[model samples]
Target: MSGVVFLILLLLGLPLAFTLIASGMVYFAQNPELPTAVAVQRMVAASQSFPLLAVPFFILAGHVMNCSGITKRLIHVSNLLVAWISGGLAHVTIVLSALMGGVSGSAIADAAMQARILGEPMQASGLSKGFSAATITVSALITACIPPSIGLILYGYMGNVSIGKLFLAGLIPGLLLTLVLMLVVYLQARKKGFAPTQANPPSFKQILEAINQSKWALLFPVLLIVTIRFGIFTPSEAGAFAVLYACVVGRFAYRELTLSDITTSLSESVSDIGMIMLIILASGVVGYAIAYEQLPVSLTLAVTQVTEQPQLILLMALAILLVVGVVMEGTITVLLLTPILVPLMQSVGVDPVHFGILMLIMVTLGGTTPPVGIAMYAVCNILRCSTTDYVKAAVPLFIAVLALVVVLALYPPLVLFIPELLF
Candidate 1:
């Protein structure tokens, strides 16, 4: 009954956080035996999680980097590396997304940044606004699987999986998504007759200079991972380090960040943090209801009644996630559904870390999709592209990403190899 209400509310365009709280209240009403105050307690408890401290710090760090001119420098470096390809701006957008994944962690943020910075140039260079929007928005899936991905962090925290393992697990798949997206651009650009930004491939000297110029931004992820791996920082503390690193790099190295920029970043971070925190708070009640319902056990039984093959179970879960991603906001999906799905995977002998990367990718990929995709709307709005054209241009890229997800699903090592080696 509560599920029906929640879905109807969601369909009616109610805010997700309120919908969660309202649905949980309905559950409490139905039971009457349980105290209503439990919901309040759970909501407060959700915000008390120490690991959640990372959310705000990371959000601020991303904002700081964006305002400090680091994004432009990274864009310059990506262009030097790949703008010589057949689809110059398209390739740059993809590579920049991969790089930004380590820094920004939020796919929507990365997509919006690129759409604003690259969308017009792509148009000026003769690419359709729809294509430009689709490419930039979809490329953000790379960030969802990269280390420091907020979605991955949330999954790890909620599922009690090792955050470090999840980070390493995402490394290869994130890079693979980069290559796969680039290939899609190559084919589409070749067919469209899109010219490379550079008439010729950049020389080694030029590439090195570009790297030197962008070294500060490039070093961020490495520093973050190294600090976390060696016990210099916990995964949660890495968020604080990220904030400090961005500040230092922006102030001393780039010499571009200003007091006004910081004020703006903080103001923006507050908005993002408030929204996520509200969702987290409301989800606590939904989570409690699901647990009280023993939903994971029921799901496990339902799944096991089929084949019980770990691989097939995982495939089904991935498929379900892909569908869910198309309609749900990625962060909320991770927060609300991860608990339900993780146990089901564990029953089939699947590694939670491997599933974590797959889950993050598919869910984050959701934001690039239609009907309710935040990143999709952000790019289209920025580019002033029509949804129909955006959807049409996105079809091939969707197939490419979906194919990559299928391959990754079949081969666990592709996702787990680095985590095994590192840990």
Candidate 2:
């Protein structure tokens, strides 16, 4: 009953947060034995989580770093490294996304930032608007897999997996995504006669100079992982450190951040934080309802009645996620599905950390597809490209990313290697 309500509300265009809350409330109403106050209590209890603190702090940190001179320096470094490649600006867009992933952690934020900064330039440099928008939107998936990824943090929290391990786990997959996407850009650039941003590769000295300028930005993610791995701070506290790091880099080191910029960043952070937290809070009710209904148990039984091979089970789950991801917001999907899916994976002898990383990528990738893909709408809007055209231009890049997902899915060791090595 609640599931039906959720779908109807979601399709009716109710905001996602409200859809979860309302659906959960309907579930309680239908039961009649459970008190409605449980819903309110559940909502309040959700905010009491300490680990969840990472979400807001990281979000604030991303906004602050964007306003600070960090983004500009990173952009310069990306340009120096990749501007000589075929489809140079496109490569820069992909590289900048990988770099921004370490700093921003939010795919939508990275996509929006790159679209604003690089969108027009790509088109002006003779790249099609559709391709430029697709590149900007899809490359942002790197942010979801990189260390300090907000998706990983939430997955860890909900599934009771190790945040530090998840952070470590994301490293290889993120880099692989970057490499594959760059290859796609190179091939597409050649076919389209897209010119390189530079006639020749950057000199060694020039590359060193650019890296020197962006050293602080580059050091942030490395320091974050080391601190977490060594028990210097929990992932939640690391979010605080990230904010401090961004502020110091922006205000003191680069001297580009201003009081006004901070005020604006805070304002934007509040909006993002509020939306995310509300969905989380509402999800508590939905989560409680699902558990009370023993959805996970029922799902496990239903799934196990089939072949029950761990790999086959994972593939089925991934297929469902890809479909739901198309119509749902990634965050909402994570909150709603994590509880249901994690235990199911564990039952079949799958590593939770491995499943979590794959889950994050799949859900995050949904935001780049059609229908309700928030990141897709954001980038297309910024670049003024139609969805149809964007999808057409993005097919090859999409296949490249999906191919990486398939590899990671079949070989769990690829996803788990760094986390196992460090932990």
TM-score per candidate, in order?
Answer: 0.97, 0.98
lDDT, candidate 1, at 411: 94
Q: Residue pairs in steric clash, candidate 1?
A: none
| lDDT for each candidate structure | 0.87, 0.89
Could you give candidate 1's per-residue lDDT for residues 120-160 as a string of tens digits?
99888878888898899999899898878888888888898
> Over the stretch 1-423, how does candidate 2's per-residue lDDT look in tens digits?
888998898889999999989889998999889999999999999889899999999999988988998888888999989989998889898887777663444577788889999999899888998989998998988888887888888888888999999999988998999999999999999998999989999899998988988999999888999999999999999999999999989999999999999999999999988998999999999999888989899999999999789999998998899888888867788888999999999999999999998988888888899878889999999888999999998999989988899899999999999889878
RMSD score of candidate 2 (Å): 1.2
Off by over 4 Å in 2: 102-105
| Number of colliding residue pairs in model 1 | 0
lDDT of 1 at 253: 92
Q: Could you tally the backbone clashes for each prediction?
A: 0, 0
